[model samples]
Target: MPVSPTDPVSPIDPDSTTGPDSTIGTAAAIAAATIAAAAAADDSTGTDALPYAGGNPYADYRHGEFAFTALTDLADRRLGGAVLAANDELFAERENLLLPEPAEFRPHTFGNKGQIMDGWETRRRRGAGTARPHPTAEDHDWALIRLGVPGIVHGVVVDTAHFRGNYPRQIAVEATELPGTPGPEELLAADWEPLVPRSPVRGHAANGFAVASRRRVTHLRLSQYPDGGIARLRVHGEARPDPAWLAALGTFDLAALEYGGAVEDASDRFFSPPANMIMPGRSRSMGDGWENRRRRDEGHDWVRLRLAGRGVVRAVEIDTGYYVGNAAGWAALYGRDEHGAPDDWFELVPRTRLQPDAVHRLLLPGARPVTHVRLDVFPDGGIARLRLHGSLLDD
Candidate 1:
């Protein structure tokens, strides 16, 4: 059976108090248990692998305040199916570095060349004697990636899992904006701005760096000093919708990520990312949806979405595709016009029972405009997509 994105690994207790004192104590306990468990697991497997059970392990500990979530990966494929171009990859392929799943480890594994690795690994560079890919190349291996969404980036995560001694000592990130399908040569020539300055990175860990830039970017360049391997690259930030595209399209799915819609907040992202609910097209698998941990409390799990633009919601689609057994039992829809302060909330869809692996379309009753929408799932489960089909509000 194919892996369902919403497969439950960790169940959360919604009734637990989340006060500051309780939160701190819980965090400390969880951290201590995680460390001990990881140590024990590593000793047997000879690999450092942590469970992505409840929350994001990397963001929880290493991310700090700027640690949001990664918006780019193979799951979403945000950059219009952008390709990865690297200077060298003698051990592992360059494309594996952008996989959505975390890097894997297998001890005592070797291929025709040597030890098989999961990430993009280049051959050893013995000083200046190493043959350069390009004549004017510097003493570093670089990879170019085009973002699926062209927007302002807030941060990046350079995960170097499974590579202890071969991981890059230092890494730098740069980005640029270019319209249409530009060749690699054109992309390389365009002016690139520093997103993350050259900084030391540790192996077998997620090294996150906060990017502060107002300019919208479409492409990124990752440089690893000398030569080494990197597992994955996660770029997270707000999506900037193109005005011209919206103007031409007129009416569209306001909840779509391609249109700039975003999941402002969510009760849980344990099984799958909440943002996946707003992505374009039907979810290919159960993993491509908004999934929450099973709740055992009186309250329900909910996710708030900021629409691409203010619009009048005429029809709504709630698809539970590929979620046959673990679909939400019931759901409620709410909408509000206010962006920051949502004081006036109107019920769009009253709490209703939902069928498994099916589509529910409802024609909204009033014609009131809504800038944002919230989907509340009872007891917590998975929802493939929540679409608000409406016409854009005239500027």
Candidate 2:
């Protein structure tokens, strides 16, 4: 799904903790377990294969394991993903699942429950028994997660980081579409379809799973077979939003993920994901933006995106809000009707000097229908938001 065939994998960005608000600062998580479940991972899927012998298995999933994992994280809290409810989080709070950073392990960090962990953890379960009855195979601990941008999950990463000994032996993932706001009770009862069937997991490893379901998912039910810890859960997919809702707003950010726009490919994703550039609402802080490492050599860094649909462009907003010292030096936007030769793209906004931590609204040269766009940032820096303001074209 490259806008350009030259879309080689860029350097993996250093681990970053970039969720920007209480609503998202620390939300949902995706996890993978030990090598024991390595067989379960579909090696046929590029996103499930690790290109390098890793230092951190969890790190592989983002750039190495599954290429699709690099797509927009549908359950990212920054995009409004939430860990709505968990049958149990008695050990580690469920919110830690989506911290937007690596799960750190601290020695002897004790809470009232015992040792504190950075990912979701649940207490051991005991079935109804006269003695110390073991938890039946049917017993499982579960958590409900609301997708930030509803879409079809292409792949999932289950990281059991720091959950070595206490990680669940098996896990399963199920999803369903609930367009409107749903309460915990209602969501729990909603019809659900399996995304990943019950599978073994190894502790302290990033376990990757390939999902084949084509249904648009709004929420996920993650189950830990018979109760155990799970560090994080990531659902990577393309956003599939309702066009009718977008039409109701009339003029809107045609590039908004909730409206179906997507980060097609990027040169980098560091400090934060490039996908954040089109997320809804104003960026709350520097961490709410997309950033890349400083370029030591030549050409500028760029991020290409798929527009919600064919739309006429009028103006654009490049926000560097809160990126005082690290804002891009200059930026530009280009448009394309479909993926083709490099020259198929035309300029939307010429390269213009950017003010640090400021919002710049620049009008396009003229109106034209564009189905894709590419944003180029001079040298290397972070951008809080990239708003493509325009109206959609009729089918």
Candidate 3:
């Protein structure tokens, strides 16, 4: 017989400032100086943002989260992830599983089947109905997902947001690596390695699970006990691309998602993630890039990224496409070897002026073997893409 389920920062970049209005760019020196003076007057040094003290249950309720949430979401649709198939979607569609937007709800929005929901949902099962006990194994609804950046998954988050009563009683996850694009039929019988065993989950909360497998994975299967809805699914981990594929591309972007490059850390993410600038294709709009809040306080912003591998970058493209007024006024690039000391960074591109809504590509001077690189933007602003053209060195 099945059992019933239970109901249950980052760094201190002190000189950061979003200003009163978020639209203010970092280039306004006078405004920036004033804000900096005010910040220092209060003796407010760098400290992480704090949660509201009380009376905000919506923002205060702590959900089940793991340290791996700090990693990139490899299953993001912007990175090419897709929910290929599902056993059922009677109430909601599977495409919503990887939506970048947060799950939304309308109190009375109704469809032919029932209340409309922004998530993947399945109908009540026959055996799981009032007739039989909830079976623990092989009696659940499942969905298959193709990962955007194939890698050894570190952890996963099964978001049940806005799914209070309809949330699953239990959840489990499994992953496998497949070549090219495998259809749902081919994936059904493929060897799948379990990442998360079936476990109880709390309603309307983010349920996190750390994956133990170090093997490269290209897809994931999420199982919800019996029947229910899941708002979103996030798989976080370091990307590991195939060396053979990199060789075939000849000259390719050294800092790219499809090629295995990743953002290791960043000085800010108030407006957008740094990983956005390293996506597979060009940006379509202003929001399709890495953006930081205006630097009204002090200092500049920087993002560090690990390359596909140690290689000699021959050229670079610092695209500010679509960023008209908020583009960085000046920028610089630095490179470092993988085995070098953590603080040992060498200049690849000295500070240079930048034009708004333009693509800046310059041929690099030297051939330094670099495994990682850092891009620094003056004050703060948005950047659509950063491409380092180079060939990977043979290991």
Candidate 4:
């Protein structure tokens, strides 16, 4: 049954009418109500449901069209960080754009240059008449950022929050790949491909664009028409890990995001992203982990992760760093082979009491290879990271 957004309540009663029109109407209404209720609930809890709505002035901003949420941020500075260089950063720092923390708004945070902003801000250009350090430089600002993990970029988010009037009128993105560490001049000379065409952008909002490239890239170039400020840049994509690197490391964390692992499913993403549980390093704060709403029912919350590679599990590390009182009370683990049926899942760890803001390392009884793992948390609470230490199976 298809649901119409306008009429959520059914008009025809099942007991009173059995006509074709009445039956259709009843089903449609019920479907509409169910969808609306689910969307409303997800939005209220700040979970990743549908794309963000409200306050965006751009009429062309389509919801859920951009692949921003599904992919990981390859250019995130906190994930090993990236090397950033800019033509000019007279007003603010360029590296702040890739910071893992959300842009801050400190009313009185200033420096000798001027009012310090938590973003990449350049001095306004005064045209060719003004003397400049680079006489032949173009009449625009640009920044180059090397991605922490080289991968195929699926989309980008140019967050210009708090940069209202000072935001760029248009923005474009380009990507490139090169061997070894290259200097600024060499990076600029490499053949760059367009990921996002020059397009109009709105201020004080997240501007998303779907990239069309399938080529793996290691660096990105952001060009803003003229000169302005940009708060953040998020390049989302699937990580294409180096095969040789994985071979050298041998046994590693199969569920680690840096190694291409991902959260396939979760009971809920109400408070924090489930993918955070597999991200590199311990969570810095309570908000930097996978957290769900407290459960009132008999069932508990669980998250499924695709292993980075087929591997025999030897040990596991469940970290509840920073969760404290909100951490899960108990947890269990399950695993299955790639060709195994859903019901064929086997237990890896039995349900055990979990200590708040602590680490639990459990050695498995056997060295069974698994392609996926499911972590079940009793009731509902936060988990910082799930480390599955295992030796990779030869291809």
Candidate 5:
């Protein structure tokens, strides 16, 4: 049987609310529990080991502890590669590659509405509903996908459906990354080879793109021009597991909360569909309290709330909407307790700020628990939403 990405074999133990007094011990315990569970479920596989339940296998499958059944199941779902929309220079984004909705790509039915664009003009060729061998210059379509398990992204897959005439002269996989970022903005990791060109394009059947090197890549691109039919595309890849902070970040009724001194549903007002509950905004006042400085662009306009009751918080997730300058510095997001005292002395958490039109998931580890969160704008910018999840108790 194949494993569906939506389901989890076992429910996470939510009852254990460990806090500062016992966090170290609790972390150790979780690690131990995970290892023990993996060991019992592991099956000997020459290539790599599967995780206990095998939904998201470990990076090195060889040492994984799940069963062979799990291993095979994971491979099947992850077998096909993603289809990419490429550029003339064979570059995905930097070289004239773009998406319809770059910041809100969710990858599901509702998420697929966005389109990819390559700066090329082609005559639309008609199709007879039969699968062709390659794409032509007229048809314009491509996709990007990650490979391997959801968390352990190893590569990408690109399939050029039916291009100009169902045939293309060649197809290449290009990697991209942010400028001046330690690793290649487009390349997955260091030592990545230039785009791989495919000869004899096949319709429907996909082309696999292995990662240049192992890196937790945040972007990807593809370049393809058809020699002949119309082209449709499909991209497949890893699904990132819920960020670590989510485990500790408990849920709060954000829709019923107030923001910027106005009663509103954060989700609908800020985030796109599905993740609507996560909202971001700026405020001079927090629930009718004394007003803080009200600067329209005072950085950190977004905020996330959680109900921790009496426990202490240890982590948070800040979703910076695209503009890296919006999150220019580390002091944008802050926290406070019931008495309005700054939690943890308002220490700043370092982050790789998000770029314009890109979502940057910022993780704040070792954060202290507080009843309220504050977005302190240094050079306030477009902060659409924020999410804080985790427990507030000593392990």
Candidate 6:
């Protein structure tokens, strides 16, 4: 994984579940200095402010978090035996199980062999095509990593550039929260191969070939198999340390009707809210303004949610009441910044107007670094649950 700028240090172990909040201790001072430097090094693009009417301006303030804290916690857990690392370099035994005594997070099902075991040995179930699992392979016969550090992970990095094979089986880096039963478990932001070209390894690869970076991760899962050659994997990220600081990884309580409330299945792009979209009774005509398109139709109404972050936002997701067909076209996305600064207004959906009973995704521009988010629909627009994700670097 892509390593953060922070240098490695001995991690602390705590039997309790709480985390530190940056005290006046030596460790805290070092952490503060490190964070300041890292933040200064970041170079982000696309920032805009919006104007709003009335409401608490800092509803999302509580969501703000730091990355250094996460790193400390990860190190402590790993060294203190609360986590796992390169425990077994040699895969001489069967089923290289490396589970954290107290699992940071559980898996969707035990079927995913890599759910608990960090590494495993297996040959192709089918033909001898390098002995790697098929691209369409159902069972996961590799290793797994769990972030379960309970912090806003700004990024995650995975290293797999050095291995032995030609057409190596595609490996996936998945994330989720524990107790994933009853759905809404695996909050998937991205789940695709890190590399573009298909290049396998025959032995040790480069120093930083296989590395990845992600944002807001509590549980990280790596699924890969051998393709006639074994590969090594490492995970890195912007995280909060344990025992003193914890940032809930996955979304708080979000339910997307489009994907049956299954965060994992929820596509990165938002087409609309869950099926049960409706506005409150007080709001007449419009039901829950949040609704996803059942099919890709002309002017289909949809909602787009950025990843979870910590910052100020100018706009809010309003519960319009009902899925007002074709009325959103004339509507506009509004917002305000600090000191109630009114900013420029932008069209909710630049393309065609909203189509009634249609699913579409809309973007609200000029969103400042704010926590909470809401979609304010006109009297005609409705909403069910205006769920949002993504994280802000500013702690």
How close to the true structure is residue 348 of candidate 2, measured as C-alpha lDDT?
86
Local distance difference test scores for all models:
0.70, 0.74, 0.76, 0.72, 0.31, 0.30
Model 1 lowest lDDT segment of ten? 1-10
Q: lDDT by residue for model 2 over 165-239, one digit each (tens)? A: 688878999999987899899998899999999987766666777676778989999999888887777777778
- What are the RMSDs of all candidates, in order? 7.6, 8.5, 10.6, 10.3, 17.9, 21.5
Q: Which portions of model 6 miss their true places by more than 4 Å?
A: 1-120, 127-140, 152-168, 179-203, 206-215, 225-232, 241-395
Q: Candidate 6, residues 8-127: lDDT per residue as tens digits?
A: 122222222322221222223434454454345322321111222235322211111223322222312232212222222332222222221111112232443332322233444353
Model 5 TM-score is 0.27
List ranges where model 4 is wrong by over 4 Å.
1-67, 108-110, 130-138, 340-343
Best by TM-score: 3
Q: Enumerate clash totals for all models, in the order shown.
A: 4, 24, 2, 0, 90, 106
Which digits, one per residue and each the tens of the lDDT, describe model 5 over residues 300-349? 32332323232444444444444333332333554555444534435435
What TM-score would each prediction reach against the true structure?
A: 0.79, 0.80, 0.82, 0.79, 0.27, 0.28
Q: Candidate 4 on 18-132: residue-level lDDT in tens? A: 3321222121232233323323321122212223244533332222223233456788775654646899999888998888665655555678987778789998776455465
Kindly state the number of residue pairs that clash in model 2. Answer: 24
What is the alpha-carbon lDDT of model 2 when measured against the actual structure?
0.74
Candidate 3 per-residue C-alpha lDDT over 63-137 given as tens digits, one digit per residue, 9 for 90 to 100? 542456555678888778999999999999999988866676665689899989888999977655577755645
What is the Cα-based TM-score of model 3? 0.82
Pick by lDDT: 1 or 4, better one: 4
